[model samples]
Target: MNLNLAVISGDGIGPEVVREARKVLDRIAEKYGHEIHYTDLLMGGASIDVHGVPLTDETIEIAKSSDAVLMGSIGGNAATSPWYKLPADRRPEAGLLKLRKSLGLFANLRPAILYKELQDACPLRKDISDKGFDLMIMRELTGGLYFGARETKEVDGVMTAIDTLTYNENEIRRIARRAFDIAGKRRKKVCSVDKANVLDSSRLWRKVVEEVAKEYPDVELTHMLVDNCAMQLVKDPAQFDVILTENMFGDILSDEASMVTGSIGMLASASLNDSKFGLYEPSGGSAPDIAGQNIANPIATILSAAMMLRYSFDLDKEADAIEQAVSQVLAEGYRTGDIMSEGCKKVGTTEMGDLIAERV
Candidate 1:
C-alpha cells in the first residue's frame, strides 16, 4: 500500500511531535511493505512569518489532494499581532478553522483512552479510574451555535449578546450515521446527547438522530440531556461507547469527557467527512510554556497518526500495531514529565518517541 500524507506542523511543539509520528509511520511502512510519502506545509505562526497569512492557498490545495492530514498543535504568543487582534479570519486559530471548513470535515472523533499504568496519574479515585475507560465522542463539527448568528445591541437600556443554535436534517443524519457506525464497531451503544426540552434546534437534532436510529436497528440507542450526560461521564465513563451530539454540545462535552483518561496529552482526535482525506490531531493544545523543553508528551500525536491510518488509509492492522506499541511503551514504565509517577524513568520527548518507535 502507498499513502500520500500532508504534514502540517503548525507552530510551537508541532514540528517536534510530528517528527516522532513520522518515524513511527516510517517503521510501519518498512514492516508492512507500504510506501508513505509526506509533504510538509506551514500553518499558524509559521505561515504568518513566511507568507503573512495563517493559511496559504497552496497549503490548502495540497491538503485537499492528500490521502490524509497530520496536524500538530497550532498557535503561540509570537503569532499575535496588534493589527490582527481576534478577527475571525485573521486570528492564529483561524488557520485551523479555515482548514476544517475548506476540507468539509464535519465529523470529529475524540477518543479518551486510559492506559492502565497511567491510572495513578488521574485525579479520580484509583478504584473507579482503575477499572479503565475507553470511549469516543462523535462531535458534529461544522454546525450549531459556533456557526450561528449573534444579535448584540442595546435593548431597553441594556446591552446583550445573543447566539443562536441551529441544525438541519441532513447534517444531523450524516453525523448520527457516523456515530451509529462507530458504535456498531465498538460496543453497539449510541447515546445521543442534546437539550431537547429548551431548544427547538436540539429538538430537531434529537428528531433526526431518532430517524437515523432506524437504519441501525441492532445498535442500542438512548437519549440524554446534555447536562446529565456531562455529569454521567465523570460518574461512569465506561458505560458509554459513543456519545454523539451537535456542534456546541460536542464542543463542551468532548473536552469534559477527555478528562476520564486523566492526561490531556494522551488523547487523540480525528475530523472527517465523506471523503478519504481527513484531519488528525492531538486533543491537547500547544503548551507554549513547555514547547521547547523536549518533555512534552507525544502519545496523543502518535495516536492521531494511528487514527489517520485507520480512518484515511483503512490500514487497521497497522493502526492497531501503533496503538499497541504505545501501550507497550507505557507498560515498560517510560514516562514523559506530564504523566510521570514515582519511580518511572522520565525521558525527553524525542527519546520517548524513539522508545515507542523501537517497540514498533
Candidate 2:
C-alpha cells in the first residue's frame, strides 16, 4: 500500500510535533511493508510569513490531492504574535477553519483515554480516576450556532446581538449514524447530548437522532441534556463510550474531557468528511512558549497519525502497532514534560518519538 499524506507543519511547536509524527509513520511503513509518501504544505502563520496569507489555493489543491492530512497545531501567542494582529479571516486559525470548510470535514472525533500509567496525572478524584475512562466525542461540525447567521442591531432602542442556531434533519441524522457506527466498534453504546428542553434546534436534533437510532438496533442509544451530560462527564465518565453532540456543545465538552485526563497533549482528534478522507491533528495548541525548546510533547500528534491509519487508511494492524508502541513507552516510564511524573524518566520531543518509533 502506498499512503500519501499532506503534512501541515503549521507554526510554533507544530513543526516539532509533526516531525516526530512523520518519524513514527516512517517506522510504521517500514515495519508493515507499505510505502509512505509525504507532501509538505504550509498554512497558518507559516504560510503568512511566506505567502502573506494564512492559507493559499495552491496549498488547498495539494491537500485535496492527498489521501489524508496530518496537521500539527496552528497559531501562536495571541497576546504578542503578529498573526493575531491580522484581520479575522487572515489569521492563523481562520486558515484552519477555511480548510475544514473546504474539505467538507463535518464529523469531528476526539478521543479522551486515561492511560493506566498516567493515572497519577489525572485531575479527577483518585477513586474516579482509578476506574479510568475511554470515550470518543463525535462532534457535528460545519452546522450550528458557530456557522449560523449573526448580527447586532438596535431592538426597542437596545443594542442586541443575535446568532442563529440551526440544524436540518439530514445533518443531525448523518452525525448520529456515524456515532452509532463507531459505537458498534467500541462498546456499543451511544449517549446523545443536547439541550432539547429549551432550544427548538436541539429539539429537532433529538428528534432526528432518535429516528436514526432505529437503524442501529445492535447499538444501545440514550439521550442526556447537555448540562447534565457535562456534570456526568466528571461524575461518571467511564459510563460513556461514545458521546454524540452538536457543534457548540461538542466544542466545549471535548476540551473538558481532555482536561479530565490530565494532559491535553495526550489527546488526538480527527475531522472526517462523509467518506474515509479525514484530517488528523493533536488536540492541544501550538504552545509558542516552547516552540524551539525541543521539550514539547508529540504523543498526541503521533496518536493522531495512528488515527489516520485506522479511520482513513483502514489499516487496523498498522494503527495498533503505533498505539501499542506509545502505550509500551509510557509503561516503561518514558515521559514528556507535560505528562512527566516524579519517578518517570523525562525525555525531549525527539527522544520520545525515537523511543516509540524504535518500539514500532
- The Cα error of candidate 1 at residue 204, in Å, is 1.2
- Model 2 over residues 173-262: C-alpha lDDT tens digits? 889989998999899999999999999989999899999999999999999999998999899899999999999999999989998998
lDDT of 1 by residue, 260-359 (tens): 6779899999999977679999999877778878988988999999999998888999999999999999898999999888989899889988998988
Give per-residue lDDT, candidate 1, residue 255: 88
lDDT (C-alpha) at residue 57 in model 1: 84
Top TM-score prediction, candidate number? 2
Candidate 1 whole-model C-alpha lDDT, 0 to 1: 0.88
Q: What residue runs in model 1 are displaced by over 4 Å at the alpha carbon?
A: 78-88
Q: List the residue pairs that clash in candidate 2.
A: none
How does each model score on lDDT? 0.88, 0.95
Which candidate gets the maximum lDDT versus the true structure? 2
